[model samples]
Target: MSDDVSLMLRASRGDRKAFRSLVERHQQSVYNFFLRTTGHPEDAEDLTQQLFINLYRSAGRYKPTASFRTFMYRIASNLAVSFARSRHRRDGVSLDQMLDEGREPPRHRLHDDPAAGAEWSELEEAYLAALAELPADWRTAVELRVGRQLSYKEIAQVMGKSVSAVESILFRARERLAEKLEPFKE
Candidate 1:
C-alpha cells in the first residue's frame, strides 16, 4: 500500500496525527493546483481548506483502488470546476481577469537578472493569458497532465472521461496553446 493510503487508513480509524500528516504532505501541491487553476490567492486558499475538510469527512469512503494522489486531485478538480461555474454566474468576468488584474499570479522566481526576470515574467503572463482562453475541460486536462504530471489514465480518471477523450482534449489544448504562444516564440 502507498504511504498516503496507509495514512488515510489510519486517519479513517480516528488517527488525528495521520490525517494531519496527510494534509501536511499534500496541502502545498493542492494549493498550487488551485492557485493556478483559479488564478486567485484567496479562492485557492479557500478551496485547499475545503478539499481537506471534505477529505476528512469522506475518509470512510476512500478505497485504495486508485492512488491517494489521484483521489485527492479528483476532489480538487471537482471543487475547482464548481467554483469556476459559480464564479462565472456571479461575476461574469472574462477569464483574462487572471492576467489583467494588475497583480501577478504567484510563481517561483528562477532568475536574478532584471532583464531575464522581466522577459520571463512577460512570457509567463502571456502563457497564462493563452491558458485562460482554453475551454474549461481542455484546460483541466492540460493542467492535470502538465501541471500535476499525471498519466493520461490518471487524468482520465480525475476528469471522469475515457483515456481517448483525455488524449483528444490534450491534443486540442496543446494545439490551441501553441497557436496562442507562437508570436511569443520570436
Candidate 2:
C-alpha cells in the first residue's frame, strides 16, 4: 500500500496520529484545490477544515478501491457542490452573479517578469474572467485536468463521471475559453 493508504488504513483503526499525518500530508493540496475552485482564501480555509473533519468522521468507511487522492477529491467535489448550494441559498447570489460581478478571480501570473506591464495585467484579467465564465462543473473538471494535472480517468473518479464525460467537459470548456480569449490573440 502507498504510505497515504497505509495511513488511512491505520486511521480507520482509530489511530489519531496516523490521521494527523494524513492530514498534514494532504491538507495543502486540498486547500489549493478549494482556493482555485472558489477564488476565496477564507472560504478555502473553511472548506479545507471541513473536508478534513469529514474525512476523520468517515475514515472507518474508507475503502482502498482507488488512490487516496481520488477518494479525497471525490469527497471534495461533493462538498464543493453542497457548499455552493448552501451559500447560494443563504446569500441569494446566483452563480452567474458570483462569477461575473464584484469578486476578482484568484490571480495567476501570465508572465514571469514582475514588470510585465499593463498589457500583461489586462491579459491576465481577461484569462481569469474567461475562466470564471465556465460552468462550475466544467471549471472543476478543467482545474482537475489542467491545474492539478490529473488524468482523464482520475478526473472521472473524482467527478463521479465516466472518462469520456470528463473529456467532453474539458473539450467544451477549452472551446469556450478559446472563444472568450480570441480577442486577445495577436
Candidate 3:
C-alpha cells in the first residue's frame, strides 16, 4: 500500500498523526498475524505493540524499494522467529502453545447439539495443538498465507524466500495440517 509507505515516510519525518493513522489502518491485521501465529492473545498483543515500536524506530531507515506491507511483515516474521527461539530457550514452550479465541467455530451448528459442540471443541483443540506443533518457519508460512491472506509472492517477499519455496512450504504445511485434521473430517 503506497499510502502506508507515505504514512511511514511522514512518520520518519516525525509526523505523529500520520503514524497514528498508519497504525489504525493495519494494527488489526498485524495483531491477527501475531495472534494466529503465536496462539496466545497476551503474547500476540505484546508482539503487536513491539512491532509498531520497532517500525517506528526504524522509520528513518526504511526504503520504499519494495511493497511496504512486505517490508513490515518481514520484520514481523523475524519477531516471530525470535519469539519462538526465546520461548524454546526460556521454558520449552514451543510444543505446548495453543490458539484461543483467535478463530471461532460456526455457532449455529455448534449449538444444535451439545454432543456435537463438545466434539467440535475437541476437533478445534486438536487443530490448534497441531498448528502449534509445526516448525516455526512452517507455522509462519501458514499464518502469512492463510491468516493474512497474503499471496504466494507476497509470502515469499515477507519470508525472504523464493516464490517456489513459499509454494513448497505451503504445500507441505497444508498436507501436514490436513493429516492432523483428518480424523475430524467426518
Candidate 4:
C-alpha cells in the first residue's frame, strides 16, 4: 500500500495528525472545486469546511479501493448537491443568487492602459455570464475538467459517474458555453 493509504488508514483509526495531514494536502484542491462549482468564495469556504467535517465523521467508513483524493471529492460533490437541493427546496434561493450575494461588485481599476483594461473587463463579464447559463451538472463537469484540471477518470470518481459520462457532460457543457458566448464573441 502507498504512504497516503497508510496515512488514511491511520486517520480512519482516529489519528488526529494523520487527518490533519490529509486536510493540509487536499484542502486547497477541494476548496478550488467548491469555488469553481459555486462561483462564490464564501459558499466555497462554508462547503469546504463542511466537506472536511464530513470527512472526519466518515473516517470509520473509509475504504482503500480508491485514491484518497477521489474519496474526498466524492464526499464534497455529494455535500454540494445536497446543500444546493435543500436550499432550493426550503428557501427558493438559487445557487446563482447565493453566488451573486457572495461576489464583490465591480469597481473601476485605475489602469495606465485604459483600452486593455476595458477589453479585459468585457471579457470577464462575458465569460462569467456564459458560465452562469450552463446547466448545473454541465457546469460542474466543466469546472472539474477545465478549472480544476482533473482527468476524466478522476472527475468520474468524484461525481460517482463513469469516465464516458464525464466526457459527455464536458462536451455538452462546452457546446452550451459556446452558444452562450456567440453573441459576445461576434
- Which one wins on TM-score? 1
Ranked by lDDT from best down, the candidates are 3, 1, 2, 4
What shift in Å separates residue 23 of candidate 4 from its native position after superposition?
A: 1.2
Tell me the TM-score of each prediction against the true structure.
0.82, 0.80, 0.80, 0.76
lDDT of 2: 0.76
**Reference-based lDDT, residue 79, model 2:** 78
Query: Which stretches of model 4 miss by more than 4 angstroms?
Result: 88-120
Per-residue lDDT tens digits for candidate 3, residues 109-139, read 2132466646556567667656776788899
Report the lDDT tens digits of candidate 1 across residue range 83-181: 877775323443346446764443322233456646555557667766766666777778888889999999989889999999999999889888766
Worst 10 residues of 2 by lDDT: 89-98
TM-score of 4: 0.76
Candidate number that wins on TM-score, 1 or 4: 1
Residue 113 local lDDT, model 3: 42
Note the Cα lDDT for every prediction shown: 0.78, 0.76, 0.79, 0.71
Predicted model with the maximum lDDT = 3
Model 4 RMSD vs true structure: 6.5
Candidate 1 worst ten-residue window by lDDT: 103-112
- Per-residue CA lDDT of model 2 for 36-136, tens digit only, reads 66656677789999999989888888898768888888888887766765764223343345446755443443333546534455456657666655667
Question: Candidate 1: misplaced stretches above 4 Å?
Answer: 89-119
Clashes of each: 0, 0, 0, 0
